[model samples]
Target chain A: GESVGLHLPTLSVQEGDNSIINCAYSNSASDYFIWYKQESGKGPQFIIDIRSNMDKRQGQRVTVLLNKTVKHLSLQIAATQPGDSAVYFCAETGGGATNKLIFGTGTLLAVQP
Target chain B: GAGVSQSPRYKVAKRGQDVALRCDPISGHVSLFWYQQALGQGPEFLTYFQNEAQLDKSGLPSDRFFAERPEGSVSTLKIQRTQQEDSAVYLCASSLAGAWRTEAFFGQGTRLTVV
Candidate 1:
């Protein structure tokens, strides 16, 4: 029953506002989770990541929260800008030596100016 | 150092044709990864390489998909007898594995269109 999913398929918010993207994963053994932002015709870029040992991690203008009990992960973007518009994905890397990443469905975040 | 680089930014091939995509990871990076991104979809892991050894390749869809990082630096993904369903953007990522943990750097990607 290992699966990764996004809570919302799409999200829209006004510029300068805060945006929260949520994800749910069923793999309890997963130890590392990362959020990536992918623009059109581009590769997914790393945003933030959290280890299973920790519940939260923060990066420049971005924060990631992990809740192992509910298998939930969330990314909070502070002062969302129009340039932040892209498809956000949650990927889990664990369970083996390869540390292959298992991706979620994704949420297309559209920043409206 | 510069970011990861993937060649053949765009490639079009017939259904039965075979195609090779190249990836030049960041200098000194010991971990290499390959992923495929379909239109409107997230990147799916295809394989991973540590140094010159491919530690895992369970994500490879089929035997037709072959990947190699002989020198532990540059890598290549070859798809034999391409199919229409194989069309997507191939991404390569590199990470420095050591005491200092860091994020993986991605390449622009190679978009392969199979007709």
Candidate 2:
């Protein structure tokens, strides 16, 4: 069975500091990966995504690093803010016909001001 | 309208009851997906629809769960004889294309509580 799991259940960081969340996926066939942020009582919001062809992708204040050799994915947030406090989930999808996403257990990020 | 919309932000149902959750995807979107999320857990795939065609429903939990996208825009997920274990948040997402490379936008989600 394919599974995606986070290295940490929760991560606490200072508001002005940087935060890094790690994820491990078992499916090497997964070509598309996405990082999503979910606040309380809200749905998973897409933050950044990277294809297997690329090792790193950067957004406004976020970055996603994909390591195919180790089947590891990481999300890095710069200058973490209170508003960035939420549960972060990493999802993966392959090039199958369905292309349904497989999500990992989320990592709660708490920003301490 | 602007994004994926789900009706009944919260639902409370007694055991053995039936419930239906609705999802209105963004206009012109070709792909619609349904996921279930438990407390403190990531969303799990339930089903997926592409232009009224159910491409994949292997993620459906059991036979009690049924989803339909009649016209390819609005979808309904119906649960029969619901159980306490069915309590969770039902999320709907839509993407412009059905390909894996496209990004999907999610709705606020409907919280289902079975007592």
Candidate 2 local distance difference test against the native: 0.91
Cα error of candidate 1 at position A4, Å: 17
Off by over 4 Å in 1: A1-8, B98-102
Query: Per-residue error at B18 for model 1, in Å?
Result: 1.2
- Per-residue alpha-carbon lDDT of candidate 2 for residues B47-75, written as tens digits (9 for 90 to 100): 99999999899889999999999999999
lDDT of 2 at A45: 95
- Supply the global lDDT for candidate 1: 0.87
Q: How do the residues B29-73 of candidate 1 rate in per-residue lDDT, one tens digit apiece? A: 888989998877778889888899888788799999999999889
TM-scores, one per candidate:
0.92, 0.95
Q: Model 1: per-residue lDDT, tens digit, A5-107?
A: 3443788889999999999986898888889998887888988888888999999999999999999999999999999999899988754444578889899
Please compute the TM-score of chain B alone for each predicted structure, in the order given. 0.95, 0.98
TM-score of candidate 1 chain A against the true chain A: 0.90
Off by over 4 Å in 2: A1-8
